[model samples]
Target chain A: MPDRVLRLQRIARATAVRAPARRPVMIAIAGDSAAGKTTLSGGLATLLGPGRVTTICVDDYHRYDREERRKLPFTALHPDCNYIGIMEQHLQLLATGEPILKPVYDHRTGQLARPELVCPGDFVIAEGLLPLHTKLARACFDIAVYLDPPEEIRRRWKIDRGVGKRGYDKHQVEAELQRREQESADFIRPQREYADVVVRFAPISEREDPPGTPLSAKLLLRPTIRHPDLSKVLAGDRRWTIHLKLDREENGRPVDALHIHGYAPREDSQEVEKAIWAQLGLEPGDPIHTLGHLANGERSEPLAITQLILLYHMLDESR
Target chain B: MPDRVLRLQRIARATAVRAPARRPVMIAIAGDSAAGKTTLSGGLATLLGPGRVTTICVDDYHRYDREERRKLPFTALHPDCNYIGIMEQHLQLLATGEPILKPVYDHRTGQLARPELVCPGDFVIAEGLLPLHTKLARACFDIAVYLDPPEEIRRRWKIDRGVGKRGYDKHQVEAELQRREQESADFIRPQREYADVVVRFAPISEREDPPGTPLSAKLLLRPTIRHPDLSKVLAGDRRWTIHLKLDREENGRPVDALHIHGYAPREDSQEVEKAIWAQLGLEPGDPIHTLGHLANGERSEPLAITQLILLYHMLDESR
Candidate 1:
């Protein structure tokens, strides 16, 4: 037997779970349903390369199916409606770079399906409704992000994504959103306080952009974790590209808010990407084109820049 | 948080999976289809009581469903038909008293069903067709048992079990049995070499018993593990109930052959039970009547004694 497996045997006999020497870096991308979490996590995973990244949707731990949740008084976002203990346990396992047989909550059927065996790789992107639900689950991540799109944008995205496709209508989704609002407020949004980065993608309210323009991105980078030095990206002659300003949060703590315009010229976004990519000390070529693709085949420069920064964090941690 | 969970947290940060202080006792009851693995394991689990035993069927790790297997050349019994690595991984996890979301193979619909989360209790009964098929899987158990019902009896049990209920005609079932026999010989029966106990329930060939007579049991207890001393049960005037004698295995090695007659009177089997129960030193109340029950409600004295001896092994392990 290989020495690693033999070590595992010794650990099992010792009545203790000992892991291998290599541990994967953990990243959490948390947000409400239809919050573009899939887009972000999938993009990051793609950049990390196949078999080198394990993408875990923590929602697979839901305690009930969609129909079952309809019967309960609370929404699925509530901690009581999911197997948080199992989530915490699995997170702990993955954090230690071990394998897990993760449950598959099939969204197409609105039910839980057979699980699949998942072995963690060099990086794990655990994205879903409640990956950041508990303190224990939160502690597993080296980088935590919360998607905080304004309520109106999120509502529009939900309606646009589900209407006529999920057997849901505009009014029904609106009502469902209204019903979930309390649990969302009580459980989901509060996770933003713990995130190292908070991202909001929406149209600047004062501007009336063209109908087809992508939403811009505003990332509030907290000092909780060492973030990439965006000084060069925000440096000279980049006013048309991005703006970095100090902003006071509700708790009166100042945070660095890095804003990137969705309508920035392709050259400007690529230039910004090059700056961050350079700091990562990669060999020549940039993996820029692989980062910001939406599932529907549309592209967003703001989304690309957001992923680049996250990619930087993951690479920095690995280094 | 408890001190144990705190220890787990530390292990995770250290990039290794160090387990808690306690581990489960693993028992492998391996046999062919309809060869009484479930009956034996269920009886022991019932004796052990609720929330203290996790029953795992290694068949859950099958790589293909019944429909999918129809197009393949090999029987489901072949090692190539299942996820052996995942099965071994889960067994290691359970052996260390951890939790796993085990896959589910639904026999009724001949399809794979959703998986479930399984937490190991103090005792884990991992009974299935191929649990002891590999050196790795065999190494996970503290006590290994192989059910070796005579070929005639196993065939009869399969036919009786499948004939009207499973949409199986007598001819079709016989053909299936003939088909599985090669794989059974190649992969299944060979596992007996690795078991601590080899149990075979069959009527003695020389005796012409009446129709519907319960089968007697012959247990080949190997010295791979310390078995409880059955001197008192075989001592004195209990010859009519059970016979213990020195036997030579096919390998020409000495083994203890413990035979209990199914036709023995209830009081005689009860005497054998008391002897083993006294050795276990459990609660004062005997839990005797609870053993030896078939799913259809028939009772077998020989079966009860077999369970009693296994129960002793498990309780002894915990001690």
Candidate 2:
């Protein structure tokens, strides 16, 4: 045999032998930029304990920093500029209980910061620009989530966040949103179709207490290879029931607000979210935020339950 | 005009105006695996002086570490597997005199170690895998270099180097090389075509006891850009010439082996190197073992002069 062939076989064998035995699980949380993705991820990480969970920002994959993105042909939303394949490959390696060198994009300086070596543990949460856009990266994740708050809600969230640090006033923030909307409109919205769960945090209705919904979080769970079943949570038993109302405003008309009930959410489904509210230690009378609308001080019992219940199912699935 | 559009235009103007006014010259050094590219870049950096010259390793863009690459479909050499576009964009930004947050790759742990903030300097030398591959990155550089040592020499060097840390003996090293060659054959070899200058180091042939080429070097200068004219260096009238036969191997092969002469290395480059060498100036000809490379050995005329001459050109062009 040629010496080279012999060497190849040996390296393959050595690599195989050295490879870690435990497989890492990948979880992707897709949301609009600054749509509480980090905050939510951080909360979950803290709850799960840092050692069991690893968090990765796809934002780190930005080709250029904030300042340079303006000069590029496409916005940061474009998949061509970020190393999507590399991110996918790294996720796979991490899922397999191996370590990877991750490229970091520094938000402060808006440059490729440095390579960060990430070792996967129990869960690898990959969040960033278009994690689900690429087929390979999407394949690596065991569970996927897309946060889909209403446009107004998301706009307010962005404005509030940007106003303090990004040096944008209310008007400037509003303008920046319009500018970014076109670039991300096609790309960001479509990811919802691929999400295992689409989370929307909005208000209950225009007529709720204080004449505005505080915070109602809604989720559209889609079945994927990793998560084939959602019946556990979708099965509407009071155990999983979130009491909330959803209203759609179209053509200057306020449509009827549908109230969600707690009994057997759907037939022929598993009770996945039993005791979810209790897990969050919430009660029927407890005041909480609604989803899809961001009116101030709107209170809803079911929407809050829905938010916590979905989270319950997700955490359980990942575990 | 829409209020948002107006604001975006204003932000764009402010950013464009705020961006660095005097962009620095970027130099890219490309080479095959273990082809002494790092050594050449380091030598130049040392000669140019650190404050004025910054060296960056694009190896940080690797999606996975050595171990993780085992399971990856494409190795780090593959464009898809690396964040090449991001790397290119960062290079472009640096060339424009902007500071970037670059990912850090740790060789010892084989992971993404950290994020480093790199500010552009007068001479930025970027070296690593596929430095010259992409057009965007290529367009950003003022100079490009490809190190083309004979494959046989590169293989030998890889073997010698891998044996110590990788726990590979001669046989294992040979096997690893064979395995790597297959993957690298497709991705690495072709990049050489893009180089503006091709450099190779070997012993002068048929010179019995002709000043032993000590750490000898030779460069084939092909100017790709209009700015840096090397007519002065090629003429070799006023520039320094090195006459070391260090390239001769044990079996009568040419492998640059000695350190000889340096004619009029730039004033700053000389001062920086002198400062570094002063610490190692235990004795005139004492060998300094650093990261497995030998330095400050027997004086050879040609090798030193060649390295210095290249440094002079690089520094002069940088200014």
Every model's DockQ: 0.32, 0.09
Instruction: In angstroms, give how far residue A53 of model 2 lies from its true place.
Output: 0.4
Could you give candidate 2's per-residue lDDT for residues A42-90 as a string of tens digits?
A: 5455545579878889877665567767777777777766665456545
Best by TM-score: 1
DockQ, cand. 1 = 0.32
Candidate number achieving the greatest DockQ relative to the actual structure? 1
TM-score computed on alpha carbons, candidate 2: 0.47
Flag clash pairs in model 1. A16-B19, A17-B17, A17-B18, A17-B19, A18-B17, A19-B17
lDDT of 1 at A190: 93
**What is the RMSD of candidate 1?**
4.4
Model 1 over residues A150-227: C-alpha lDDT tens digits? Answer: 988888888988884587888999988999999999999999999999999988666787888788999999998998
The digit string of per-residue lDDT tens for model 1 on B2-110 reads: 3324655664445333344257788999998888999898888887786788898998888899989999999899999988867887887777666777889987787
- lDDT at A248, model 1: 91
Question: Each candidate's root-mean-square deviation in Å?
Answer: 4.4, 16.1
